[model samples]
Target: MLINEGNTNVFIVTDAVLNKLGIPAKVTDYLDAKNISYHVYDGITPDPTFNVVEEGLRQSIAANCDAIIAIGGGSVIDAAKMIAMSQGNKCKPQQLIGILKARKPSAPLYCVPTTAGTGSEATLGAVISDDKTHQKALSIDPRMVPLAAAIDPIIMKGMPAHITADTGIDVLTHALEAWMSANASVETDYYAASAVKSVMHYLPLAYKDGGNLKAREEMGIAAHYGGIAFNKAGLGYVHAIAHQLGAYYSIPSWSC
Candidate 1:
């Protein structure tokens, strides 16, 4: 779907684990069949730092990639957003931090979320950590939103139980925070409610049986809905404090 948007050379962004596992072959194989040019940069860490973004941007620029595709969880997606935006603006990733900092929209960005959590693919924000301090900085721009995403359950079927549980709780947190925000409205309420209900029901089934395609699909949708809800309605203290603590301690959200 992304290549159909007229992108020629592509830059594939992901973590070392996913790259080593050869999970990106899911997309690369298709690209190969279609004769699309692409380069894979798999240096993203769990909490990506500005250095990581810089390295990715450098590689993508050197490869002359016109499009960016993220194929991992939240951290990978976030890094891809910054990489695309920086490449589009012809600047460093650190310079793009903060609200509405970009002079133009990001380069065409697409996502294949291997984990049904964080929903970074659906949102307009990306968080990049400081190289030395590990403190997170959020960049918000409508341009940061991906052009498209694939939430294939087959891709998620290999996720371990612990990650599934952790990400499911993250989905629930996003929905609840959005619903409770003072900025929430009728439109946000619909998405938030749907996500909350789906997580409450399908999370357990997905956790119990990773091969349950129906459960995986529902959770994936729920995570996307939660992201949309929060994107519009906003989030609260849970995210406010959790983000800092997670960045500070190098832990993921909901681990405590």
Candidate 2:
């Protein structure tokens, strides 16, 4: 509806995860009902690379998209951030890595997370891989955060059991690491603790029954809290080492 108010030409960023599960139907339906034109770039891999970002950008530009909607797991969100950032800054994904190098704001970004992990939809950073070596790169800028998000448990209901378990642990890890950070302020600690409590109470339920909308919704909220907490407090050794391994292994951020 927000997109409907504007004459927005949208680029849909996602991966095989959502496509296989047919989660994009609602999105297409909403856009179609509004007579909105869109292009789907469902080519994102597990750990997105510079090439992936470039490919997405190519499609976006080809379609003359003015906005983006990411609709899958962490990798999908990460790729969306890179694609949007590249579109706005008019640079390669490799050029934007490390700290805040973005000279301008990214295209208006939105997310519809299919998994309650990474919380990338709410974060200011995206981890992208190199085009050549498959090594990871960190692109951090305030503009990378999505302007809005859709955490619909109905779409998240189709996640596999293993993914549900892994992503739930990912949420807990984010909260735990944030709570243990040296810069943990009262505000951040509160968010971290709340996220931890929510994950403890709801993750198992969600894992056991992916169809449980209440549990799925709670986990989604918890993941968001963890993202906010970490963004404020900063993580410690675990995240540092994990980042290294993730870069070296070229694995998904959630797995790390």
Candidate 3:
């Protein structure tokens, strides 16, 4: 339900990498064939700053978009989440930079991930950096979660080895942290274990062969389960330290 078939305007959010790979075109072509009006904001960066969210917001509002669809990996999805969240809250993204700070629900948001990383499509949290200070600010509102997501292996089969390895490791980290969480429940344990097992079996295959659809599918499902586990159980030192590294060094979260 990302876009209505007719007479609907959508703001498509993405990044340069996905645009270069023509991932957004998949969605745009569908929209085009269905006669769904869409505007594209593809300026999102790796660590997504408040400024990037604002520029996207400006374009979205100018277009009077009724829905938003994000197509890419974590950065693109996270930026789109914040843009949608900020729209409904009627405030700057920085204002809602803490636990459940958003006063209103987000605008309609959907995700189509291009990599088996971050699982931003299934999470309640999004991170944005301060344009001025370069420090990371987090927003953890259930409202920010995407309304729906499309996990297609065709989109993920093109990932480079380094990224596949990095994100696969990142997926393992998520499950491990979730399983170790103090708040972890049996529900979280099941998903965490499933994700860990999937990574153990499939990560090497995907890393060695990007075109392996089965491996790509497993990695994507592993990431999704990792997100589900962590969403409830929360994360541990890995994410915290990763955040610090990302803030200080400008490293992407999926980087190992």
Estimate every model's Cα lDDT from 0 to 1.
0.93, 0.87, 0.89
The ten-residue window of minimal lDDT in model 3 covers 1-10
Best by TM-score: 1
Candidate 2 ranges beyond 4 A from true positions? none
Model 1 local distance difference test score: 0.93
Candidate 1 residues 106-198, lDDT tens each? Answer: 999999999988989999999988878878899999999999999999999889999999999999999999999999999999999999999
**Highest lDDT, which number?**
1
- Pairs clashing within candidate 1: none
Clash counts for all predictions: 0, 0, 0
Local accuracy of candidate 3 as per-residue lDDT tens digits, 108-136: 99899888878779999998988678688
- C-alpha lDDT (0 to 100) for residue 125 of candidate 3: 92
